[model samples]
Target: MARVCVVGSVNMDLVFAVETLPAPGATVLASSMSRSPGGKGGNQAVAAARAGADVVLVAAVGHDDTGAALRAHLESNNVDVGGVIALPVPSGTASIVVDAQAENVIVVAPGANGHLSLSSPRLRDLVAGCEVLLMQLEIPTDTALAAARVARDAGATVLLNASPVGADPAALAQLAEVTDVVIVNESEARHWVWPVPHLVTTLGARGAVHRSAGGETRVGAPAVEAVDTTGAGDVFAGVLAAGWAADPAHAVRRACAAGALATLVPGAGDCAPDDEAIEDALN
Candidate 1:
């Protein structure tokens, strides 16, 4: 197995369940309210760890009780929290609304996450030690770029998940120069052309489309029933990283199967399936 480093965000998700979303200023009663451990970085790290990757999580959380609980949760799941910095202000929190159909709306207040930064020494160390460096936009752009550069320089494969939203074209291209594989959905792919030929575009139920490194071959998603599509992309990235680390030639198909299997469950990181489960699906 390869060592994987995840640089991203961590937050306590306060969720409200309702029949449907309400328009501005319109009042609607929520059927239930709950809290869950979430954030793009944490979710992806958890997904990768659960998928059998040796994972280290680099992130930030506030000094509040929620932050403490989040750290405990990550530790319990066997994710390395050595990179997480706990601060006194702006505790991490997100407001999420999920409808009966499992559709979701989220608002994030970065809080302590805004204070997170990765030093050059730390970056170099992590890049040197890990086989794969996975990142997201939830952290500072410069920090994420720095980590990618170091990982690329250190000869570790770099995978960037362009999620939560799109990126500027110039920045995206620059990032691609240091990136080994780029994973995005159809909408994300449309934002900028990738310089790296090993790109994968995830298309919901229709499956995902993959362009190989040589840029001559392609692959598509396997058959599966999707329930809640929340963390499918993260699961895809995690499984893909695992496959690439173990056997680069077989990564794409195995990754697609794990991602599709994740869709059968609900929630983000919580939805990622074990290796055997995904392999069984692939078989």
Candidate 2:
């Protein structure tokens, strides 16, 4: 199995299912409400693990019960939580509203995730030893950049999922410089331009495109009814990271399928498909 290290945030997600998302200055009632373990880092780590990778997560949570549950959830999913630290503040949280169409609007409170730093020697070693380092913008950008530098220096492939993109251009640019692959959704792709070694742009339902110095490869997604699209992109990123070392083109195809399958169920990490499910989707 590929050794994948994820450096990012851990949050307890508060999800509300609504008939429609509320506009500014408008209030809407939710049809259902639930809480789950989430956060881009946590979701991707679980996705990678399910895709048959040995995944380790470097993140932070609060000393609260929510934080404990988040760590336990990752552990249950076969992710190594040795690098996860607990801080005095409350854990990060995301308030997500999912519409009937599977579209979502999210607001995040960074909490302890904002305080995540890479000052631990063990965490640095973990990042350096991985075959691929996967990251997102949920944590401190500098921390992600620092982990990327470590992984890059140690000859590991670095993949950055630039989600929730609104970081400083210079910081994002510097991150792209050391990264081997940059993953972004269609909307994010249109906004930020990076001169990275490779770029993977995910088009929901349609498929995904991989562009490198050599050329470009496009893969189509299998048709599926999406129940919730919350963690689909993270699933794509994680599965892509897991399979990228063997074949970029094939990885993109599998990642697309995994992403589509993730939407077949509700919630984030909990809904990620296993290896058999991905192959079943492909066949």
lDDT of predicted model 1: 0.77
| Cα lDDT of model 2 by residue, 1-283, tens digit | 5899999988899999999999999999999999999999999999999999999999999999999999999999999999999999999999999999999999999999999998989899999999999999988899999999999999999999998889999999899899989999999998789899899999999999999989988899999989999999999999999999988888899999999999998988598999999989999
Q: All candidates: CA RMSD in angstroms?
A: 2.3, 0.7
lDDT (C-alpha, whole model) for all candidates: 0.77, 0.94
- Give me the displacement of residue 125 in model 2, in angstroms: 0.8
Alpha-carbon deviation at 9 in model 1, angstroms: 1.4
- In model 2, the Cα lDDT at residue 104 comes to 97
Best by TM-score, which number? 2
Residue pairs clashing, model 1 = none
Q: For candidate 2, list the clashing residue pairs, or say none.
A: none
Per-residue CA lDDT of model 1 for 218-258, tens digit only, reads 45566665555666777788777766777855677767777
Worst 10-residue lDDT window for candidate 1 reads 213-222
lDDT of 1 at 184: 88
